[model samples]
Target: MHILILPSWYPNHANDIKGVFFRDQAQALAHYGHTIGVIALQRRSLRTLFPKKQNNKAPHFELDEGVPTYRCQVLEALPKIPYGNYFLYKRAAKTLLANYVEENGWPDLIHAHSTLFAGAVASEWGNENNIPVVITEHNSGFALNIYRPWQLKVADKATQGAQACIAVSPSLGEVLDQRLPSSKGRWEWIPNVVAERFNAPASKKYSAGPTRFLNLALMTEKKGQYDLLYGFSKLIGGGTKAELWLAGDGPIRAALQELANQLEVSSQVRFLGQVAPNQVPSLLQQVDAMVVSSHYETFGVVAAEALMAGLPVIATRCGGPECIVAEGDGLLVPPRDPQSLASAMDHIAKNLSEYSPHAIAERSKSRFSGAAVAAQLTYLYTRLLTSNSKVSQPKS
Candidate 1:
């Protein structure tokens, strides 16, 4: 079926490293024989006063890896802008998308990623064009902290109107059901999938001296990088001989590094900023365990990938991590608690042999294989199209 996929974040030529998750899902849907068109929200747009700045990081409009994506730039220089403000972008994007679909034919349905922005867009477009929409909630609710007075009301209505809603983890689904209680739509559990490369053998080696812990999260406040550093320091003070390695980059990198230095654990904390996706498996192999301390997450892709690579994960019981990291696979700590994280780390370091890489990998595959995700998504799309088709028929 023809499908229009709208995502809040997507990888562009200028910033290919970001939004790799959205890119993977779009590609997988296309590969499964669905015609997919994308409208991604560009979170930043250069102001009219600074046209020169636009030249440096201009967004490119083209198809990347067979997914035709059109980006709608959002004005973000104004600091006080209300959160969940997608109407302007949606108006602009809908104009372009409507014209494209009119010249070509209308797609069967619109599939939106992330409830706040993409959900708003798909809701507006589907309502205007008399098409059905489906939303995949990727965040628990932290991203909605910036929403204005009426934004939540609008989101509630949009979610209620959708043909179906999907949550990447059970934790996210619980939040959605709680926030939008009026929405009686079918909510499905569809987690993200790991690529086949992650299941390959580990290419790197770890020394036998100290246990190495790896973190693969964006260096943002929600990721709780500072909390990780604080917890690691506490672990060191307890006489544990383990070094921490952090992967990924964000606005908080400098501050997190400073925090590490201040804690006198700079020697133990190594920040490997933004490794390529292909190089992730090798890094996972070299580490004894992976730690995820994000304050909120829709699904912890890195943690899942670590388990797929035959490595144990120690993640906070927040969002998707609570659902993905099970008893035999890894340890789950309370969110934003350094003491809890530290204790979990100490436990893993002491009993490292019990968490077998092969068993962890096998468990991860049961929940997050790419083929399974693709099939579930296809089912959702088909259901929406069939339901809408029947609704449009004349009464018998």
Candidate 2:
């Protein structure tokens, strides 16, 4: 099968982390022996004009890890115009798809990530060309209650037009069902794949040091870093010998640092800003456990990654972690509660022997590895294709 991916956002460069999961999924499908391609449309804001380096008006093509990728960058200069940015995205996507079809012929299926614009673009193109489309939504706007009316309308249309709609977690699926009841029957829960680099042997014994708990996420208000600091203070006050390590940086880093200082836990907390994706596995191995302090998540990816590396996790009942963390894997506490979070952390630190790293890794791999997710996606693709064949043929 030939599958083409359209992501609302994608890595502009090698180190870029935006919509990286879409790229990983495309690679996984390719590894499953299907021909895969990616067409990414990135819109740059006018604020970045001063730092402009090169002309990016033309589409850029490359064979990224054996999968063909086409990228087009556009400047968003008409923010005040209604749907101006979306119009630019549609134009670029249509042009890029035409070029891809000219080179490789029409794909057997179109898989779009997120509904904001990519899913809408793919839905429009598929409907016009008589192609099948599958949209996997990863946006948290619905859960966060931040989607504007126009955005919600676009999401509704895109989901209604797709052959299938997928959510990265059961909670996200439920949210989609509630928001777009018309597409409820088409919804499926599919998780993002954990990168293969996270593989590590299960630790037989805890690392010799102050029990280190790591939190890997952007230092944002929604990530609940402040609550994490307060919880860590409570844990320390309760006489637990532990260290807190925060990986990743964001706009609120200075504020979080200030909170740590005010709480006087700054000495026990370490901020390792913006840890690279390649460094995550080793970081997991170095730490005794991981903590996810987010108020909400579409999918708690870090928790899955930690479990894959044989490290236990203390995740909140935030939307996604409830699905990823199982019994014996770690404890799940209510979100935004410092006392609950502190208690859970303390419990994990004291009962490390009760959580088997080997068992956690085995279960996590079975659910989240590339091979595992690829198999599930292949099954979905085959089923959709077979059903489509019985219905009608594509228009030439």
Candidate 3:
């Protein structure tokens, strides 16, 4: 079956880590022998929209991760403008859909990732074009109470009209179900796909210098980087030979560094800003364990990735990590509690040899492998298409 994917967020040439999971999932589906077409809109400023002479605004088409993908650049500087989505993205989406249909024909399923505009676009356009639409929620915007009124309005319209709605974690599913009660009973909890590279760090050396703890989350307050620093400070207060790798960059990098300095853990924490997606596996393999210090998450992808790489995780009882970091695989402490997190860190550091990397990797693979995610997504698409066919047929 052919699948048309309308992603609300996608990795671009500039930001490879942004919504890259959706891209991976699309490739996974393509690997399953299904024809896939992705329409990823790059919301750019007015100046960036007008390139130095391109042929009729032809989409930058290329095969992304083995999936045929199209990047449609749209001007979205004035989000507060009237019908901003419709004018900037929705209209362009319709044109792209026409081009795609002309070349590849109508798809069996229109799967949208996230719901700011992709869900809305798929819902509106798919209905008009007589196609089944399914939306997978990835962001924690609604759960975090960060969504604007306009954003919520569009999100509701899209979800209400969708054949099915998916959330990356059970926690996120519950939050969405509450906000959109009418869309209940159609929610599925599917997680982000972990890359095939991450396997158990079975070759980890115990006496290889100071123990390294890897945290690859964005430097934000919500990510609890400060708490991690505080916890690390306490853990190493007794002169424990250890180092912290703070990966990923965000708005609060300066503040997090300052916090580390204030906590007197600055010397030990290495700030690795914005590591590429491809480099994560090696980092995981090198580290003794992974740390997820998020205050909340839809599904701690980093934690899952770490587990897949055969490294145990030290995660907070944040919204989603607790679900991924199972017993024996990792420790889950309360969010934002320095002393509790500090204690967990020290305990894990001391008992590093007790955790089985192979077991952790195997568990992660069972849940989040590309093939596994592909099977689940394909099943959902098939079910939706079958139901839609039944609904469309006249009563015999």
Go through the candidates in order and give each one's C-alpha lDDT: 0.77, 0.87, 0.82
lDDT of 2 by residue, 1-396 (tens): 999999998876666667767877888889889999999888789997677475434349889989999987877887777678788888989999999998988888899999889999999898888788999989898988887777788889998788889999999998988787667767799999987888757444577768899999988899988899999999999999999999999999999899899998999999999986777888888889999999999998999999999889999898999999998899899999999989999998888878888899889999999999999998988888888752245545
* Best first by TM-score, ranked: 2, 3, 1
Q: After superposition, which runs of candidate 3 have C-alpha atoms over 4 Å from their true positions? A: 45-59, 201-207, 390-396
Error of 2 at 394 (Å): 4.1
Residue 133 local lDDT, model 1: 86
Per-residue C-alpha lDDT of model 3 across residues 1-396, encoded as one tens digit per residue: 889999987887533788878877887788888999999887777777657875434347887666777777777767677567556788888788888777777788789988777888998877776788889988888898887776777888888888889988888888887776666666788888886767655565544778789899878789998888888898899667789999989999998888888888888999988888888877777788888888999898999998888888888887788679888897998998988877777877888889888888888899899888899988888788776763353211
Candidate structures ordered by lDDT, highest first: 2, 3, 1
Q: What is the clash count of model 1?
A: 0
Q: Alpha-carbon error at 56 in model 2, in Å?
A: 12
* Residue 245 CA displacement from its true place in model 1, Å: 0.7
User: What's each prediction's TM-score?
Assistant: 0.86, 0.95, 0.92
For residue 352, model 3's alpha carbon misses the true position, in angstroms, by 0.9
The runs of at least 3 residues in candidate 1 whose Cα sits more than 4 Å from the true structure, single-residue gaps closed, are 14-17, 45-60, 76-85, 102-104, 140-145, 184-186, 202-207, 276-278, 390-396
Model 2, total clashes? 0
Q: How many backbone clashes can be found in candidate 3?
A: 2
